[model samples]
Structures are given as C-alpha cells and as structure tokens.
Target: MKLETLDALLAARAAKRAVALVTALDGHSEWVVEPGAPPSGLPADLLEAVRQALASDRSGVVEHDGRDWFVQAHNPPLRMLIVGAVHITQALAPMAAMAGYEVTVIDPRRGFAAAERFPGVRVDGDWPDEALERLVPDARTAVVTLTHDPKLDDPALHVALRSEAFYIGCLGSRRTHAARLDRLRNAGFDDADCARLHGPAGLDLGARSPAEIAVSVLAETVRALRRPEG
Candidate 1:
C-alpha cells in the first residue's frame, strides 16, 4: 500500500468508516475503496470485488481477469447501543463489549446511567430520543431497548427503525409488543418499519435471569448479523 493510501485507510478507521486496501498480486497495483463509494483511479472491474469484500467483512484473494487480487477489508468497529440503564444493561453491556461491540448505555436516570456502575463504559445520561439523535444509528450498529417504558424505549425505537441499523430489538412480552406496535403505527410508522422490531428481544432460550436474557439477545444479534438475510 502506498503511504497516501495508508493514510486514507488510517483516517477512515479513525472516523469509524469502512474502507479496504486492494492489491493486485501480480502487478503490485493498489486501490482504496470506502463504503458507499468506489475508489478513483482504479479499473471498474475491481470495484465489484471491493464491494463484495466489504460486505462479507472478509479479507481474501479473488481471481479476477486471470489474475489474483487481494481485498483486505478495514471496517469500523461494531457497536451496540442499549437504551436502558437497567439490570439487563448491566449484564448486556459487558457482554457486548467482550464480543467486540463498542457499547453505549443511555438513560435519563442519572443514578442508573452512572459511570461507576458501568466502569469504563460510555454512559449517556440523556433522554433516549435525543441521545439516539446524536448517536446516529448506522448499518454497523445494533440497537436494543430494554427500558420497556414507552416514554424511553419508544423514541429510541423511532430512531432505530429509520436508520440502517442491522439489529433493532425491544424487551417485552407478546402483549406488550402488540401494544408497542400499535403505538408505533399511531406514530406514523408503516408496516415495513414495524417489521424491523425484534420484540420480546432475543432467541427464546427460556432466559429468566438478567445475564441469561442478555446472552439470548446477543446470540440473536450475532445470528442476525452473520446469517444470510431472508
């Protein structure tokens, strides 16, 4: 990689954006492609390869035009935004961070959102709606709302539903989820928007404890992220 391209890749990593360094194995030619944009000064055929590499989050060599081309993906770190500083969050935040998610816990309740409780994690003691607006859920983000309170979780749901966030979950029972769906409908969300919510969040592993429930939720998230979309 050229110094200029290395700088660009480093800058993308700093900004938490996806980029890739592609090398033509035979000729030692190179290119950098970031998410949503193709690199300039590269042949058009390699653009498809770069796109594929970034999507799979993999670094590999592919055969192109009778030559081997290597595409090494440099993606932004994965993030999990949990909108509730409750017991479940206490369990989930650490679990998420352990699994490579840059976790952020948000709750307006200062006591619940206290840093001392979370220790070294990002705690945003802001209202859910406003906090999500600033946080800006993106494709690499997974959002989970554990508050169950309509005032808190609903606003965050609104933001997550509209974003490119890969996962959007809310903690509640079937009945509660039905009520929540009605509220979202009344709030102007279409069927498509409502379809995104993984209400009763997590795989049904009969999780009773907070830690177990967090495990199920994280498992579901990982499943959704890694598996092919239906």
Candidate 2:
C-alpha cells in the first residue's frame, strides 16, 4: 500500500464514506472502488463480485478468472440514532453501544437528553428533524423513534424516509401506527414509502416493560440489518 492510498483510505473512513480496497492476490496491485466510481479497467464479472462483497460487508479473497483477488469493504462505523430520549431509549442506547454501534440519542428536551440519562451515548440536543438532516442517515445507520408524540416522530420520519438509512422503526401500537400511516400518506408519501416504517416497532415478542420492548426493537433491527426481508 502506497502512502497516498493509505491517506485516501483514512480520509474516507473519517468522512464516513463507503469504499472498497481491492488487491490482486498475485501481483499485489491495488485499487479503490468508491461507492459511485468503480474501476473501469475491471472486468464486468470482477466488478459484480466487488458489488457483492460490498453488499455483504465482508472482506475475503475471491477467485476470479483463475486469479485470486482480495476485496476488503471499508464501511462506515455502524450507528443507531434513537429519537426521543425516553426510558426505552435509555435501555436501547446502551444495548446498541454494547453491540458495537455508535449510538446517538436525539431529543429537544434538555432534561431528557441530559448526560445523566445517557452516560456514554452521544445525546443530540437538536430537534429530531433538524438533527437527522445534519446526521444524514446512510446504509450504515439505523433510525428509531421512541417518542409517541407525532410532533417529534413525524418530523424525524420525514427526514429519515428521505435518506438511505438501513432501518427505521417507530415505537407505537398497531392502531397508533395506522393513524400515523394516514398522516404520512396525507403528507404526500406513497404506500411503498410508508411501508418502510416498522410501526408497532419491535418483533412479536409481547414485551411489557420498557427494557423488554427495547430488547424486542433491537432484535428486529438486527434482523432487518443482517437478514433484510427486502
């Protein structure tokens, strides 16, 4: 690896950009495949392999055209952006952090987003929508709204739906979710877009306590992330 390429890789990681470093196993020649800019010199079959490697978020050697190739996916850090600093968030954030995510709790309330409530988690004091816009959810990010308040959840949902966040879950009942879907439809979102919301949020775990609900949501999020039903 040249110093220049190493610098570029470091910069990409810092900017949270998705990139792949490909090395020819035979000659040790290397190339960088950015999200939108794949190497034109690569064969069509080789490029497709690269795409699969990136999607799988795995790094390994691939035998293509009788030549071994090492493809390493350099993805951004996994993140969980929890909306509304509620009791569920208090439980979920810590769990997400333990699961190797960089968790951020977003809410406008000063007391709720206080340091004591979220000891190690990053707490965003900005309004949900504004904060989400700046955060710019990507494929490596997951957004969840725990606040039942439409004022907070709706705005954040609007912003998240417009982004490429991998997962979007909302904590609510089925009836509440139906009403929320109606509101989103009225806001000009189509059925396909509204369908993206995992309303009634978690899995069918029959959770009762806040901690239990958080566990369920986390499980659902992991499912969508690892084994996306899409």
Candidate 3:
C-alpha cells in the first residue's frame, strides 16, 4: 500500500467512516474510496463493485474488464448504546459486546450507572438526551432503552429517532409501546419515523428472563441490520 493510501485508511478508520481500498491484482496500483465520494478515475463498473463491497461490509476480489481487483472494506466498529442501566442492560451489554459491539450504558443516576455494576463496559452518567447527543449514534450504531420510565426512555427515544442508528429497541409491553408511540406522535414524529422503533423489543420467543430477553433483542437487532428490506 502507498503511504498516502495507508494514511487515508487510518484517517477514515479514526473518523469512523466507511471506506474501501481497491488494489489491482497485479499489486501495481491501489486507491481508497469513500462511499458517496467521486469515483476518482476508477471505471464505473469497478466503482459500483467497490460500493457493493463496502455496503456488504465484506472484502473480496471482483472481476472488472477481465482484470481482477481486490476490494477491502474498512468499516467502523459496530456500537450499541443502552439507556437505563437496569437489569436488562446487565444482560444485554455483555451479550452485545460478545456480538462485536462497543457497548455503552447510559443513566443519569450514578447509583445505577456505577462502573462496578458493568465492569469492562462504558458507563455514562449523563441524561439520556445529552449523552446521546455527545455520543452521536451513527449508521453502525444500535440504541436500546431498557428503562421503563418515560422520563428517561422517552428522551433517549427522541434522540435515537433523529439519528442514523440502524436499530432502536425499547423494552416494554405492547400496551406500553402503544402509549409510547402516542407520546412520540405528540412530539411530532410521524408514523414512518415511529415505525423504525422495535417496541416491546425482541423477537416473540416468549422470553421470561432478562438474559433470554437480551437474546431476543440482539437477534432482532441483527435481523434489522442484515435484512433491512425485511
């Protein structure tokens, strides 16, 4: 890799931006391309393949004009932000970490957000909205609210709705979710925006324990991210 190309990749990784490094199979030429940026002299078909590789977050070799090219996708680490710092978070945070997410638990109550309660995980003792604003959830992030309290969960939801986070899940019963939707509607979110939320979070596996519920929520989050059309 050229020093400049390597530097560009490092910079993109630091910024948590998705980019692709394309190299000729002959090992003679290479360039970095960020999605949505100009093609920078690459052929249209090669550019399209680079985009497809980046979108799939997979690195592979593609054939273009009888020449082979290797496309290496450089995507930021996946992130999960949990609001509430409650028991569900206890179960969910580590599971998310094991599933390759950088997890953070947010709660204004220092007692609830104590670092000891969540060793090896980030604990943010800031109000949900403020914490989210500072964290700036991105397309690679997932947000889940385990606190059943409206004062806390509601504010987090408002911020998550405005973010590009791939998934937003909230722990609540169906009736509670309905009421939450009404509140969001009252706050000016339309049905489409509200629809993005996975209320009563988790797949209906009839989970009864915090650990089981965490499994379902993570499964649903994975589904939402991998099968976006579904």
Candidate 4:
C-alpha cells in the first residue's frame, strides 16, 4: 500500500468510519472508498463490490473485466449501548461483548453502574441522555434500554430515535410499550420514527431469566442488523 493510502486508512479507523481499500491484483491501480462520501470516478459495478464487502464486513478478491482485484474492508467495532445498569444489563453487557460489540452500560445510579458488577465492560455513571449524547450512537451501533423506568428510558429513546443506529430495543410489556409510544408521540416523534423501536424487546423465546432475556435481545439485534426489512 502507498504511504498516502495507508495514512487515509489509518485516519478512517481513528475516526471510527467504515472504509474499504481496493487494489488491483495485477499491481496497476488502487482506490479508497468510504461509503459516507460519494465515490467519484468509480464504475457502478466496482462501487457495488465495495458496498458488498463493507456490508458483510468481509474482505476478499473479486474478478471484473477479466482482471482480479482485492477488496479489504476496514470497519470499526460494532457498538452496543445499554441504558440502565440493572440486572438485565448485567447479563446483556457481557454477552454483547462476547458477540464482538464494544459494549457500555449507562446508569446515573452509581451503585448499579459499579465497574465490579461488570468486570470487563464499560460502565457510565452519567444520566442516560447525557451519556448517550457523548457516545453519539452511529449507524453501526445498537442501543437497548433495559431499565423499566420511564424517566431513564424515555430520554434515551428520544435521542436514539433521531440517530442512525441500526437497532433500538426497549424492555417492557406490550401495554407498557403502548404508553411509551404515546409519550414519544406527544414528545414530537412521528409514527415512522417511533416504529423503529423494537418494544418488549427480544424475540419471543419464552425468556424468563436475565441470561435468557439477554440472549433473546442479542438475537433480535442481530436480526435487525442483518435482515432490516423483516
């Protein structure tokens, strides 16, 4: 790789942006594409290949016009921000980390957000809204609210609804979710925005225990990330 290209890749990584590096296997040409920016002068098929590589988070060689090209995907770690450091979060945080997410648990209640309770995970003591503002959930992020408290969960949802985060789930019963939707609608969120929330979160796996619920939530998150239309 050329020094300039290497520098550009490094900079993208530093900024937590998704970028791909494409190089001709015959050592003839190279291109760097960041999906957020319009890729100028790239053919439609080549751009589509880059999009596929970035979407699958996989790098491989592809053939076009009888010429081979290697596409390398450089994507930042997927992030999961859990609001409310309650029992569900206790199980959810570690499971999310094991699944390759950079997980962080947020709660203003310092006692619940203690680092010891979540050994290898990050615990934020700031209020839900404040913490989320600083973290800034992006397109590669998944945000879940495990705290049943409306005071905490509602504010976080307000911000999550406005973000590009791929998944947003909330822990509550169907009736509770209905009330929450009313609150969001009254607070100015449209039906389309409110629809993004996966309320009573997690797939219906007959989950009762914290760990089981965590598994369900994680599965739902994965589904949202991979099969968004469904």
RMSD for each of the candidates = 2.1, 2.5, 2.1, 2.9
Residue range 1-230, candidate 1, lDDT tens digits:
68998899889988998888888899868878874777566666677777878889889998777989898988898999999999999999999999999999999986889888898799999898898899898888999999989999998998899899999999999999999999999999999999888989999999999999999999999987888383
221: Cα error in model 2, Å: 0.9
Of the candidates numbered 1 and 4, which has the greater TM-score value? Answer: 1
Q: What digit string (tens of lDDT, one per residue) describes model 2 on residues 1-230?
A: 87877988899888887888888888857887785787788777667766888889988888878988898888888899999999999899999998878999999987889989889889999999999999989988899999999999999999999999889999898999999999999999999899889989899888999999999999988998898875
Best by lDDT, which number?
Answer: 3
Q: What TM-score, computed on C-alpha atoms, does each candidate reach? A: 0.90, 0.86, 0.90, 0.86
lDDT (0 to 1) per candidate: 0.90, 0.89, 0.92, 0.91
Q: Candidate 4's residue-wise lDDT over 108-215, tens digit each?
A: 986888889899999898989999999999989999998899999999999899899999999999999999999999999999998899999999999999999999
The TM-score of candidate 2 is: 0.86
Ranking by TM-score: 1, 3, 2, 4
Deviating ranges (above 4 Å) for candidate 3: 1-10, 36-41
TM-score quality measure for candidate 4: 0.86
Residue 52 alpha-carbon offset, candidate 3, angstroms: 2.5
- What is candidate 3's lDDT per residue for 4-101, written digit by digit as tens? 99899999988888889989998678879886884668888778877888788889998877889998988888999999999888999999999999
